[model samples]
Target: MEFGVFATMAEALDAANKAQKDLVNNYSLEQRDQMISNVRKEFEKINDELSNFEFEETKFGRVEDKIDKNLGGILNTPGTEVIKTRAFATDKGLTIEYSAPYGVVGAVTPSTNPSLTVIGNGISNLAAGNSVVFNAHPFAEKSSSIAVKTFNKAVVDAGGPNNLVTMSANPSLATLQEILESPYVKLLVGTGGPAMVKTLMASGKKVIAAGAGNPPTIVDETADVERAANELYLSTGYDNTLMCTTEKEIFVSNQVLDRFTNAFVESGARLLSEEEANKVRDLIFVELESGEKVVNKDYIGRDASKILSDAGVDVEGDPRVAIFITDKDDLFVQKEQLLPIIPIVPTPNFESAMEWAIEAENNNNHSASIWSKDVYRVTEFGRRINTSIYVQNGGTSAAFGVDGTGKDSPTIATPTGEGITDASTFTRRRLFAMANGGNYIL
Candidate 1:
C-alpha cells in the first residue's frame, strides 16, 4: 500500500487544532524532549522510504543524497535548545524576558526537499513549543504525508499529543486558502517560488517565505583551480542541484579560465558534443508562461548520458550533458538553468569578474560561492553581495554543512529578513514587568 492516505486537508486541520488545544493545556517539557527523540528515531526509519519516494516521484536528485539531507535534518538543525529566562531588578522592581511559542504554526513545504523541509520545520516548531499544520506541495503530497505521520506517531508514542504534527492528504488551491485564512495559525512559513512567497507576505500574517535563488560562484585567478573545480562539481551535483544554494553559474578570471576548465573536465566532467549541446540549449532555453525563454524541467537532474540520448545524440559511454565555454554576455550565463549543464564565463580581472558575478546573481540573496586566496578579495565580495551565505574557498552547498563545518538545514531561500532559520527563528520573545512599591516615570 502507498504511504499517504489521509482523508483531506480539512480533516487534518481539525485534528491538529484539537491536538494543539490539548497540548497547550497539558504538554510538558519532558514530553517535548520525548517528541524530539521520537522524531529523530522516526527519521531514521523513514529515511529510506522518503528517499525512494522522492526518486520515484520527482526523479530530480539521487536517492543517496536525499537520504543524507533527511538525516541531516534529524541530527542537526537545532533541536530543543533553551532560550532561557532572565530577571533583572531595576528602579521599577523586577523585569523578566522569556521566549514563548506562537501557538499553532502553518507551514508550506516545497517539492525540492519535501521530507527534509517538513521534518526540519516540524522539529524546530516542536522544540519551540508550537504545534504545526503542514501543507505539502501537490507534487510531493505522499512523501510529505508519510513524514508527518511518522513524526506524529513518534510524538504520541513519546507521551505527546497524537496530532501534534498534522498535514493534508490532498493539498489544493482551496486547501491552501483555508490554511492561510485560518486565524488559529499563529505563524506561517513557506518554501517555494516567488509567487508563493508573495502570497504569504500579502496574507496579513507573520510569514517566513523561502523563495527563489540564482547563486553565482566566482573563481579568481589566485584561487586553487583544482580545489575550486572539485568543490563546484560536488556542490552542483548534490541531489542534482535541487538545492537553491547550489552554484548556478561560474565566473572565472580569463587568466585561469583555461586551467579551471581543464580541471573541471578532468573531474569526470565531459564537454557536450555540438549536436548534444544544441539539443540541451533548445530544451533548457524554452518559452516561459510570459513568453520568456526559460529552462525546462525535462533536462533538470538527468544524467549527462541520459540528457544527451534524450536529445537524440548517441555516445559510447557516459557522456556529460551540455558544457560550453561562453562569454559573459551569453544568455546561458545570465540564466539560472537548474540542470547538470554549466556555463563558464571569462572575465578580464577580479573586479570585472565580481561585477558580472553579482549581476548574474541578481541580488537573490540566497547564496554565493567564491574561490580566492586573497583575504581582501573574499572580504570585498562578501561585503558587496547581500547573500544569506557567502561561502569562501568552497561551493554553495558547503554553507549548509554539505561538506563544511556548519550544521545542515535546508538553507531557507527567502531568508525572510532572518539570515538562517533555526530554533530561534521558530519562536517569539515576550517580556514581563512588575512594579512593586516603586514609582516609574512615564
Candidate 2:
C-alpha cells in the first residue's frame, strides 16, 4: 500500500484501508508511539515551510500566528494515551471492552486551517489505529497535499505501514463526493461551515463535524477590568480572528463598560465611534440577492488596520482590534465576523448581560467565555452558555491549549458533541466476554 497523494480517490481509499489494517495487525502500541513521535518531529522540522505555504495559498491568517497554530497542534494533540481498556466483573462472568479502530476515515479539511487541520486530524486518526483519506479543500489543495505527503513519510520512516495518510492530488468537490459514496470509508470527520456539516451528516455514517460558531463573551462588573480588557484585545486579534472560537460579540455590564473600554484602548484596540462603526459595517458587509446581509469575503481574516483604513477611518497608532458599541440585534452582533472587528453590547445588569450572551451565541454551542472574579457568576455563565469550549478569565486560544493546560486540536466537534477531539474520539468500543474468568486480571 503506497501513501501520499494519489491520482484518484479510489486509489487513495484502497491504499488507506490497507494501511489501517497493517497498523492494527502488524504494528504494536509501542510502534505506533514511535510513528507518532516521528510525525511530531517532522512537523516541527517543516513547520516554517508549511505555515508559509498555507498563509500564502489561503491568504486567510497571519504567518506568525499560523506557525504557532501548527506548533500547538503538533505538540499538544494527544496520542494513544487517550485510549483505555475497561472491564467489568459480574457474579457469573467477566467482560472487557477495548478501544477499536473505525478502519478508514473520510476527512474533509477546511481552508480556514488547512495544514493545521490535516496534521491534527492525521495525528489523532493514526493514533487511533486508523488510516485517513483526506478530501482537502480545493482552495488549499497544494498545502494540504504537502501535509498528507509529509505525514505519510514520517510514518513510513518510523517503520510503520505506508499509506497511513492519503489525499487526492486534485482535491475538488468531485473527490469529496467520491469519498462520501465509498463503502470502504467507515467514518466521516469534517471541519467547515453549515454546508460541509450538512453534507457529512447526510452521508449516514458516524460523523464528527466541526461547524460554525458565533462565540460571545461576557464582561461583568465583578471582573478585573484591566485583565479582561487585555485578554479580549489579544483573543480577538490573534491570527486576525480567523478561528471560529474567537469572541465575536460581547455583553458588558454598564457599571464597568467605560473602564473596560478605556483599558481596551490602552491595550492597542481602537474604539470606533458610532459613525465610524456604521461606515465599517457598510464596508465589511454586503447584501445578497435574497436580501441576506453577510460579511464580505474580502475582509475575512484581514488586519484591523486595513479593515479600518478601507472604511476611511484613520488612527494614530497600530491597532490590532477594532471594537464598537452596538445593540443586541445589530448585524455585527448576530453574524460571526471572521475579521478582527468586535461588537460590544452594554447591559444594565449582570442578569441582562447573561441573557444577551445566550441570545448572541445563536445556539451554536461552540465556544463562549466570561471575564469575572465571582465564582457564582462563572458557574452560572458556564452552564447558561452550554458551549463546548468555555473560557474563564482567559483568551479563546486557552481553550485550544496554546496558552492553557492540556492538549490541542483544530477540529472542535461542537456539532457532533465530541468537544475537543483526540484519538479516543476516532475509535469504537469492542466488548469481549467469557463465560467464566473472562477478564484476564479477574
Candidate 3:
C-alpha cells in the first residue's frame, strides 16, 4: 500500500506526536539504520519522478538539478554517523555525554528545496530518534507530499512506526503557526527566507533556522585564471544558483581580470553589456513602495537561456551563467538574487578584492569561496569573512564537502549558528559522570 497524507494539520500533529513516542521507545539504533537505508533506496527508486514532480509542480529549478539534490538529501546528508556520544576516562572516574532527541520536530521546508529539504530533514531527525511533521511551502506541496510519503513508507517498511514521517495534504501559514504553537512539537527546524526564519526564532521553541545568504567567490592574482573562471561559472550556474551556497558575486584581482573574463566567456558564460545589464537588472529586481528591492521570483532558478531571452537578449546557445561587469556599488552587486545572474567586480589588488567580497557577503556569514595559490591571502580573507562555508579553488559543491572536507549538508543553518547541520545538530547533548568509579577494562 502507498503512503498517505493527513486531512488536517491537527491530525498530522497528533499522528506525528504518537509516532515520535513509538520511534523513541520501541526502535533501536539498528532499526533506525535500516529505516534510513530504506529511505535511500526509496529515493533511488523514484529519483527521476521526484525530480520531475518538483520541476513541473514548482516551476522552479531543473529536473537534473533536482536529481542531484534528491540524491544528496537522501544519501549524503549526515545521519547517525555525525551524532556521537563523548566520553572521557581518567584514573579515578569516567565521564560520558549522550545525545538525545527532542521528541517531535516541527520542520518547515521551503519551496526552493521542497522535497529535498523534507527528505534531508527526515533522515537526520529520525536518526536522532525523533519524528517530523513537515510544514511544506504551499508552492511545492505536491512534490513535498510525495517526499514525505516516501519517507513514511520507507520507515514503516523498515520496521518503524506508521506515521513517523507525516504532513498535511495542504500546507499554509496558519498550519505552520499551528505547528509552531503545538506543545507536542518539541523542537523546530526551518529552512527559508528571512521572514520565515524570524518567525521560527520568535516561536519560543528551540529552532534551527537556515536563513538567507549572498555567497561571494573571489579570485586573486595568484590563482590560475582559466581554471578559476571555469570552476566559478560552473558553480554559479549549478541549478541556476538556487542553492544558498551558490556564488552570487565574483571579485577578481585586476592583474588577472582579462584572462579570467576570457576563460569565463569560454566556459559558456555570457557577459552582458552595461545597457543590457541595466535592462536585465530591471527585469530581475523590483523596488517596492518602501524602496526595498526583491527578486522577481518567476525568473529565479530558471534556465539561463530562458532568463536571458526574457530579458530581451537573443542568444543562440544556452548560456550557463549571465555575468555583468558592474561597479562595486551597483544594486545588482548588493542584493541576493538567487538567480543565474552574477555580478563581477574588478579590484586593483587582492586586498581590495577581499574587501569587496566581504562587503558583498553582507555579514550573512553563510558561504564564501576563493581561487588563490596565496595561502596567506586565502587565510586572511577566510578569517575576516568568517562564513560557515569556505571553498578554495572550487565552487560551493566543494564547500559542501564534495572533494573537500566531506561534511556536506543540505541545511546550512546560519541564523542558529549551527552551520552544516547533521544528525548531531538535531540532538540535545546531556552529560553523565561517575564520581570516583572503578575502571573496567583496558
Candidate 4:
C-alpha cells in the first residue's frame, strides 16, 4: 500500500509509527546510511524541478535561489555520520552509549520553504532512525506533498520501509493541531513564525522549533566599504530576502555611510528617496488595533522591483534590492520585512552601532552579522548580540553553508537552542552496560 500520502493526520502518524519500528528492528546502520545516500541523490536529480514547482505554487522567493537552497540542504545535510556511539570499558563492566531515535517526528514546515524543509527534515530524522509525518503549510501543500512522496520513493528504492516519510494529502491548521496533540508523535519539529513555535512548545512533547528572526547587519568604519556594500546587498536581496537568516536591517558607521550606500547602489541595489521609502513602508506595514505596526502579509517575499512599483515609485530595470536611510526608531527598521527593502541606520561609532543592532534584534538571538576589519570590534559585537548564527565580515548566506563553513539546514532552532539541527538533534543518548564483561585491558 502507498503510505506517502494519506487522507488524515491519524493515518500518516500510524504509518510513521510502523515505519519507525521497522527501521529500528529490521534495518542496520549501514542500511540506514544507504537510505540517506539515496535520498540525497534523488533530491539532487530533481532539485531544479521541485524548486520551480514551489516557486510557481507559492509565488514566494526566487526560483533560482530555491534551487540553490534545496540542493545545498540535500547535499550538505549531515546524515548518520552525526550519530555517534561511545564505549566505556573497565575491569568490572563494559558500557556502551549511543544515540537513539525519537520514533515518529511530526514536522510543521513553513510556506516560505515548503519542499526544502520537508526534504531536509526527512533526511535528518530518517538518518537518526526516526520516521516523519509532515504537516506542510496550507499554501504549499501540493509541492510539499511531492517532497513527501519523493522521500518515500527514494527510501523504498534503497530497500527501506515504504512509510518512512508520510504526510496528509491535504494540510491545514486543523491537521497541524492534530499532529501536535497526537499520542503517536514522540517529537515535534516546526519552522515558521512565533505563533507556530508557541503552539509546538505548548504541545507537551519534545519540540525543536525554528522561529521568526529579524536579523541585523552592522558595517563599521574600519570595514571595507565597497566589499561590505556588495556583500550586504547580495545577502539582504537574496531570494527576495525570504530566509530567516537574511539581514532585515543594517547599521552603518556614519564616517563611511555615504560610500557604503553609494557602493550598494553601484552593486544593483535601488536607493530609494525618503519619500519613496516612506511610501514603500506604508505599503508593506499596517497599524493594528493595538496601535502596533506589523508587516502586511501581502508583501512578504515579493520582488524588490515589484514592491517599488506597487508603492508608485518609477522603478527602472531590475533592482536586486531597495535601500533607504532611516533612523533607528522607524517601524521598518524594527520589524522583519521579508521583502528586499532594507533600512540603513547610521551610527556615530562602533559601540553605538553594536548597541543599536542588538536592540533591533529584539532578543530573538536567531542570526546576526558584522563587517569589520578590527578583530576587537568583531569580538565585541559577537559577544553583545548573542545570536545563534554569527558571521564576521561575511554575508548571512555563509551561515547557511553557501560558500561557507556552516552546513545546510532548513530548520535553525534558535529558541530551542539547537542551532542548525542535524541527525543528532533528533535523537536521545542511550546507554547499555554489561557487568563483569572484562572488555577493558586495564
Global fold similarity of model 4 (TM-score):
0.97
Score residue 361 of candidate 3 by CA lDDT.
88
Candidate 1 lDDT, tens digit per residue, 153-187?
78877878777777767787777888888878888
Q: How accurate locally, in lDDT, is each candidate?
A: 0.77, 0.89, 0.85, 0.89
| Runs with alpha carbons beyond 4 Å of true place in candidate 3 | 1-4, 436-442
Tens-digit lDDT track of model 2 for 1-442 = 3457999888898899888988999989889999999999999999999999998998887888889888989898999999999977886678889999999999998888989988899999888999999999888999998898889889999998888889988888899999999999899999988988999988899999998999998999888889989989988988899999999888999999899999998999999999999999999999999999989999898888888989999876668789998899999998888999899999998889888889988889999999889999999989988999999888877877756865789888999899989999999999988766554463
Candidate 1: residue 319 lDDT (0-100)? 36
1 or 2, greater by TM-score: 2
Error (Å) of candidate 4 at residue 169 is 1.3
Alpha-carbon error at 178 in model 3, in Å? 0.8
Residue-by-residue lDDT tens digits, candidate 4, 119-222: 88899988899998999888999898889888899999999999888888888888988898888899999988888888898988988989889999999888
TM-score of 2: 0.97
Could you tell me which 10 consecutive residues in candidate 1 have the lowest summed lDDT? 1-10
Superposition error at 11 for model 3 (Å): 1.0
Deviation (Å) of 10 in candidate 3: 1.1
lDDT of 3 by residue, 1-442 (tens): 4353798999999998888898888888888889999998988899888899899988777778778867767778777877788888876678789999898899888888888888888889888998889898888899988888888888888888878778899889999999999999888998888898889888899988898899988888889889889888878888888999888899888888889998999999998898888888889888899998888988988888888888898666988798878878887678887788889998888878888888988989999999999899889989999999888888878856666666556688998899988888889988878767655244
